[model samples]
Target: MKSSKLSIKFRITFWYTLVFSLILALVFFYIYFLSKSYSVHDLQEELKDESADILENLYDKSSRNDILYNADWTKFYDDNVSISLYDKNSSFINGVLPEHFPDKVPFINNKVRQIKSDKNIWLVYDYCYEESPEDSIWVRSIASYGHWSRILYNMLWIFAVLFPITVFISAFVGYHILKKALQPIYTISDMAKEISFSVNLSKRIETSNTHDEFSYLADAFNSMIAKLEKSFEKEKQFTSDAAHELRTPISVIQSHCEYCLDELKLTDSVREEIEIIYKKTTYIGQLISQLLTISRTDKHSFKPQKEEVDLTLLIESVIEELQQKAAYKNISLLFEYIPQNESYIIQGDTMLLMRMIYNLIENAINYGINGGCVWINLIKNQENTDIIIKDNGIGIEKEHLDKIWNRFYRVDKSRSAGEGFGLGLSMVRFIVDIHGGSIAVKSKPGYGTTFTVSL
Candidate 1:
């Protein structure tokens, strides 16, 4: 059987109750037995005093003819207390004797003892009276055991009634106390969760005025968050500054290469070298642009201008623009529109949305086989629109699939530098995120690759 799990509050309460119950049981037993011992001792002493008094009275009345024989013994006896007297000859004397009293009372030890007879228990005390040296009488006193038993029984009833009540009250009170003690922890956890998803890093967990462990924890968390916010801001500033500074140099290099190619007649080898330099400069400019875009997006500075966009026309336009590039590589580009409508409308930035589609289709063309086919399907549904771009080319490995969205992460590192700088997919992902859409890619090496955008 599986063991049931208990929460911290219940587990604490359980241990508390268990320990208290053990202590309570020990105290109850000690009190019961201690009280019984004292009661029995006091009863024995009282009996001894009564025996002495009876002996004194009998001694004073010894000279009378009928003092011992006719004296009223009923005055000294009740239902619970019994007294018996015996003469020196061991003959019966005038005194009260219980119905179940023993025939012979052992007086050699002169000690008190408890004796049971059928249903009744008795505390029997025996005493020897020396009335003159030669004549003596034995006295025995018996008290019922039911008095102390009743006292102990009532005590047990009290404990039986109070034990469960005490446990319940203890558990309830403990639960609330624990909840109050842990409330600050819950508050801190909630604040941390809010900070995780929110861009406002200035927010901190509230701390108490008292100096305690929880206050220390809150202070530590706030300090860590402050440090992280500072580090992130520095990184963003560096990216923005670096991209901006590189833009001018890249443009100067491209212009110099163009001037060299156009203004001077050069050999074929020299012209080829100039064209390569121009191509590299242009690639660097694009990389800088993508970096600036990503930095602006991180700083929440790139706000898309809202406008009605026809997604079908936008996609067709991108395909038309990239048709020559696809033709150069002999790749067939195909478009399949599920709705075939003239306009599939959405509210977004036309330029950014067009960039998003352009990146995906361009990636399909670049990565596909020379004569392979690339399929573009736009499916419209009741709730959303789906754009799928699929290519039968060199599909990505499984390990690199998740990392493709990261900036400057290339799946095939051995590819030529001119092929891709690894910024297109990153920009595509950024645009999808800004538009509150989702993009997913499924690829298997040597099979095919598929990109799905849901908006």
Candidate 2:
């Protein structure tokens, strides 16, 4: 199975949302990093100030050792800050240690270090005081980061909730905007598709009032279609004129040859040559007639005279006319009307319908083997009437089936030596199309060919 493809609007919306979400994620990360950095920096500054004040007070007191021993370490403990002091031996001297504090503090030469535990994060500032050579002491001021962590946690929740919502909203808005932007293109495409050589090419694409790219594109497409319409008109005129001009001369040649053969005394050899000339002239006349019909049909100038046509009777008449030709090859031509009493009635032109049936039967007879059979079945259902022409003849190749309906396209070029100019099927297709009917052919190379025309 083939994979389904995404439409342009969907693709554009997806890319827009993806890029926007990526940019938002980067911005959120930057903000988080900046917030954390600023919080840590502010806490470091406060810890430094507190440490300096404690050190200055210790130096001013005359009995510093007595004051140190008598200091209330619990007073320094608060919701946002914790302080701890240690002596030269790395033993805790005073101040409170928060729960779950590490037994060892890795000193960083007076710089602050961050320590994390299961409960809280701490920023420790290790300061050294040289009161005397033998009495050097270390003061460690630690501050809790629980307040900053809570702020960051709340921000994380906000981002998690808003990211998908933002993406969905952006995708929705982008889809509509892209669809509206491409609306004119869709209109232009639809109009172009409706314009064809057989259709009215005079119709132009509708343009927008705004002078945008879509408007410009519409104008350009209209101009191109106008040129195409003029080209087709010229081509149709040439075909009609050529066919008309050649018809009179071919008829004259055929008539003069017949008159000469009848009225003048001619040798047998000369008479045979004249007969060939007459036959060729007749063929040329038929070819010109077909060309003229096709030209008119292509120009949409051949308007059918609509009437209730008995399709069964039409097929029978065509078969009767072509029966002698089929008999020459010993081919049997049979017709079967499904409902004997009910007329296979349809609204169409009598002449064109007859022509269509004649072409199909003639083709089958010409291509069929000697003593083969051609069957014509007229079937009527609730919706439409079906004319099925099946021939047990030399079947057409699969590759040539599609091109058989094309004008002047022969499935087997060798068939050109016969009475066909390759216009019969093309004409049949055109007649079916103008009548708002459908025709389909099924064939296999060694078996047979079947043409089903539904009207």
Candidate 3:
């Protein structure tokens, strides 16, 4: 997710610039060719007009002499527009041709023409004047195509300079525009991260009043979160209330079992059955108590009473108390401690902290191998204190590692045949959390499991 954070903006900018460049190129080509075509058309019209103007001035409409021979044509020898005279027989009477202008080209009247001559393009126009009904003189105009070509070359150079600049400006502006357009998406993502990290569900994303797609997305997200928060609240409330309601009946059952064993004479089989009932009720009572603890913790009602706890002696006491239980399975409990010149002490809830360690060690013993060993270690330093409990037992599968800290989640083997329900690790995690510490577990299926707590 972090790697692809900028991916959306990159794709938007890339596609936007590509499309903008194509459109700009099309517009550039349109304008360029339009200028070329229009310039040539206008030049042809100008040649026709220039020739007609010159013929009107030079022609002798009243004189009876042959007009081509009688006229003095030196005034017509000028740059930009060339003037030439031709007879009706298509022979050159008198004229001036621009440099490299092909002289062999025959003249035709009443139209402007573009002709290529010796690698040069020239525009030619002919105007006819009648000396009589059957005799006439032609006034021809010639201009080079190079004059307009220079203008087009400069235009090409200008476009060459502006194309990349326009594309760059377009991409830069497009990225910022898309960023603003997608800002609401970023807001939603940040809110999601905040909710996941802090586990806070009441926060809602702010949306604009305008009925846009982003507003709709915000509405959907807020609606889903509201439903989820409501559902979780109902679940937690049910759990809390059920645990409270069942506690009294479980205590009454245990009390009756105790009274039966102490006061009434019972047969061997009846006593064993009663003992099993008492044991099962005791486990259920523990489970209910853990559920209540978690419920109170979730509601922010369970505050730990902090006191200085001896880190070294705590492990020893738990190990001593659980020694008889381990002896039943022939599992040896070992304690490893180092003073390091500093007091092996930490500030936390004594009962909760002791229970935290107690649960971990008991969990190890329950799953431990017969005649195997369990190691409980206490290490202290300036940085922090660590409590490590490890066992060579029937280890957990990789998939069950994450779910062990969740309530009532046990592996299939434990469900079929295990001493306790899967609430011990859940309570252990809660206690560690209440003391502002962290716990981690590592295990392999066939080897063993190890628990590490840091305070």
Candidate 4:
């Protein structure tokens, strides 16, 4: 979609049709020239046959003196064909010729030549012989080349009409052939898109019975999916095992720290050190919980407990809950378009939806500048309910915008620490997708960032 280049199917069909058209044109021209050659050859042969007949009569009927008078050349006269005679000096002696015929074309003995005159091609045949020791005559025939080439003319007309038709038919049939041949690629692409959407890796593409390139491609795709499924299974097991195993240690550390602070009369420095350990341990527990949630979703075990919850009240409550956190930076929170009578209700797991909203607002508050403001707007329509969270924070850079939704991806690499593990936006994306909704973000450095969630 991003590139204007043509699809493989269409490109293949286009090139196939173009090559076929070239070959077809060559064949048409060959047939045209062959037919024209045959028509002209037939006319030349007729002229030779007629000249032979006249000579035979002249030799058999009279003496050399009266031979020209006895033989009737007028028998060959027609509108488009003519028989004539000339002397040894090439002077016109007798016979008929069409009007505007090019008589200037001198006779060449025993040859057929073409002459162009009066905007027409004239086929002229000259036959020279001796009647006596001192007398010679030339028998010649002239025929209208255009008038006698009807077969070749008709063939050209037929080609002119059939050329485009043949090209069109070839293109149509070639497109279907290419489509059928490349169906396996299409099948693989469609399956890949489905896997991407549903996050299911157990499916495989079907290979063909024959051992061709397409079949090889299908086998490769199936193998890749099988590997992904195996790797995904390992990752899922590891996260679950790690989360469960770390929970006991985290609890043990927290309990020991609490006992040390409460039971022992510890110094201020010692107590603060223990408290820091407890806080870091708690943060680790939260991280493990997030990893477990993502793992369960991947395993198809994290099903939402759907219930009707009012979105407006839920958002307002989340804002109130995070008010103390935002006050740290003196950032103000504003809510807009609070409906008076209309209730914006949706079916989802209330806790998960609240977590989704909480994470986004918390991220805004964490990233916001001192004295900055965050705006939350509720937009209702016939099809979808939109929640817009906009903040005048230090906006993300252009290069980092796309990567912000990736898990554990932090944009500010120079900084040692930040409030989030960079998983909040990733979790938000997953939540919206699972609920059959969508999310989008817009940000520009030093200006603001906006998150739109449509359900």
Candidate 5:
């Protein structure tokens, strides 16, 4: 298949890739946040511990009068940590006071304690200790809240670099993998497209590789194509044979008519010749009519004007109708309707179905031996309606049994050429197919032939 025709494959891959990327983004986001939170908390705790020791040393220095008292005390603080000191008078002593601190010293001022500045996300720890009986010092450390902001800042670069890179790589690999996987399907589709109505059916899908669903599909499609090719070939042959058969009688009639017209004397012999021409014309008309019926049957238009037909009555009527033909042929047509069940009310086109039976009977009478018996048994079982026509005539060969149902195919070429149009069994098969029934013929040369029809 062409890549354009496999748009469904791309659609599925797009959705899958989209979902996978979403999940990847979510996972990376979760890891970023977790790492930022943990790193920020640990860093803050470590800074606090180091800053507390520095404040202790500063207080000792102040007590010993080792430096100027009015110097900028905030200068002693590290840049990574903030510091604030309050005197015992509850006044600002060193570093900058929180801009929005409450006027009154809160309960947290008594000992080393942590507090949050609402105006900004700052962590503040306050420490207070008695320097002397009337003097005390207070220290507070402050820093920015750690995890969330750091993660946001870092992920900007990561996303900017990763998304396009991942998409390019994924698209390249997905295309090649999908193409390899669908190669067998492409082969089968190409073969199917090449199939034409007039094809000889020598080409079939290649199945030399592995076995899978595509192999099964190829086998099934090839089987159907084979059946259709065979059927079409049979149709072509039937038409050719039918035309050839009808031409002979038409030529005879034309010749006879021309001869009668050329006669100078309008005598008894001329009248006899005209009668022969008339009979030949009538026979040609009947052949044409039968051929039309067979054509309609092939087109599935042999719709019987249906009625609730009784099996026993229908068979008796058909036998009575064909009794004269059988008598003239010196053949015995016996019908035995064994009603295995009382409910034998079948729904079908009675007239067409009767014609189906009539064709079979006439065929037997024309082909069977003098004084030969044709046994027709109708059995209405629990499941189906069975009609069997068995004749003990010159039975067909094993090879011809399969071809006998095909149009214009004859077992005895010489005999079939003389009598009917060679479409009786073909019409029978066509009618049975339209009625959703099956027909099987069994024959043994020099023994007999039996046609079993089940509906």
Candidate 6:
């Protein structure tokens, strides 16, 4: 029942008002009690002094019969003072005023008496003087109390009239100020909501005047978007390049098949044509397999069984496997292993690393001049391992050096006739990326190109 009746703001305000009102009521009650006690004390003291004067006057006259008992003595007393004078015999001289008074007047303790006729409640205390044994005085005064109901009646009006006005002004100003403070966040949220895969992510979040945490968040988000946009562009380029490369092999096979199907004679030239068709078909199949490997590598589907591999042993085996090919081209396959350590043990997938090395050497062999040098070096830095493949080949231009690692990007279109798919460096880059390594190339028009893989 309590939960259903109140809201959060109302409950908070209600509790606050309750606490405030309680404190205010307590303070007022304390003051009221204090003032009431002080008034009673003063009234009793005044009544005692008046009784002394009355007794002294009666003694000086030495006659009680001549004194008027009914004459008003109120002018001699304060407003709170009440007096009931008694003789030594305990008989009231004022003709038994207010019988509700205690029969035996209390000396120290106060007593309460309610008079129905006067509608008054008296706090009564008695005083006796030893010097005047003939007279005793009983003093009673009206005591006031704080009425909680009357106080609450006034407080209710104050709260009802003032609370809504105050809260309304506060919430009104708070809403506008909070909205302005969060304006940048709203703008960024709107922009992010509209962002799609097709959206140009070159746009960035707006920065505010303050250099605070929100600004830092905006900067970091922009950096993430930049990286995503670059990755998307790379993927699109890879798809286009793979399609073109696959089409070449498929078209060649189709053309040769069509030509052979139109032939009739079993001549030598016809046999040669048939052989060419077979070679094209075989090359097409090889291209298709290579294309699959590249696609799988790009998609991170080629999971390798990794082991600790000795770099020196791996390089030696690769050189041995490529020795005949190098010899056929008359290219010098120079191996430079300049490490004081016996073997460089690295954790990696051995087969993929071997394929990457082979591809790099094959690219050099295909492009390197006859009798030129292709240097393969393994160097170690402070915290990393480096593999440098430098070839004195038909070098790439400065403009093309940055793009050599992109798939199907060839420097010379005529030279594409060689069994190069232009995906070797791209595959090498992917392999390095998976290993948490980096690769770079440096080349000029006439000089040779150097590809450095740092792990």
Number of the predicted model whose lDDT against the real structure is largest: 2
Query: Could you tell which candidate, 2 or 3, scores higher by lDDT?
Result: 2
User: By lDDT, highest first, what's the ranking?
Assistant: 2, 3, 4, 1, 5, 6
Clashes of each: 0, 0, 0, 0, 2, 0
Q: Per-residue lDDT of 1-455 in model 1, one digit per residue for the tens?
A: 98869877678778887888788889888998899889888888777776666666667765322436776877457545777677777677877877776666566436788887776667888777775779887777778776787888899999899988987897788878987987888899899988774455778998889989999999999999999889988998998999999999999999999899989999999999999999888988988888887787777445888799889899999999999989988999999986654457888889999989998888888888889889999888787788999988888888888898877788663122126778889889878877888899999776668999988
lDDT of 3 by residue, 24-101 (tens): 999999999999999898888778777766676556455324344665656455557788777788788776778888
Residue lDDT tens for model 5, 1-455: 54666476677677767777788788877877787767667656855774566466666765423322454656435655656666776676656544554345452542333345554445556666666768766666655553345556768688768977886677667767877877877888778776542133557877855567878887888898788868865885685568567867777776767666676456888677787777677667677767756555544223556668676677778889989978986889988875553755677777777878888877777777778889999887667898899887777777777787776677683226226767788778866766678888887765667888887
Against the hidden reference, what TM-scores do the models get? Answer: 0.68, 0.90, 0.79, 0.90, 0.44, 0.44
Reference-based lDDT, each prediction: 0.81, 0.84, 0.83, 0.83, 0.69, 0.66
Error of 2 at 352 (Å): 1.6
lDDT of 6 by residue, 208-299 (tens): 76778778778788888889878966875686577667777677776767666667556888777777877777666656656666655644
Q: Worst lDDT window (10 residues) for model 2? A: 410-419
- Indicate whether candidate 3 or candidate 5 has the larger TM-score: 3
Residue 324 displacement in candidate 4 (angstroms): 2.6
lDDT measured at residue 51 in model 2 versus the true structure, 0 to 100: 76
lDDT of 4 by residue, 33-108 (tens): 8878888888888778777765665576455445455445566575456887778888876677777787568778
Off by over 4 Å in 1: 1-165, 207-213, 258-268, 300-455
Model 2 alpha-carbon miss at residue 37, Å: 2.3
The candidate 3 region of ten consecutive residues with least summed lDDT is 60-69
- RMSD to the true structure for each prediction, in A, is 5.9, 3.0, 4.5, 3.0, 15.9, 18.7
Winner on TM-score between 4 and 6 is 4
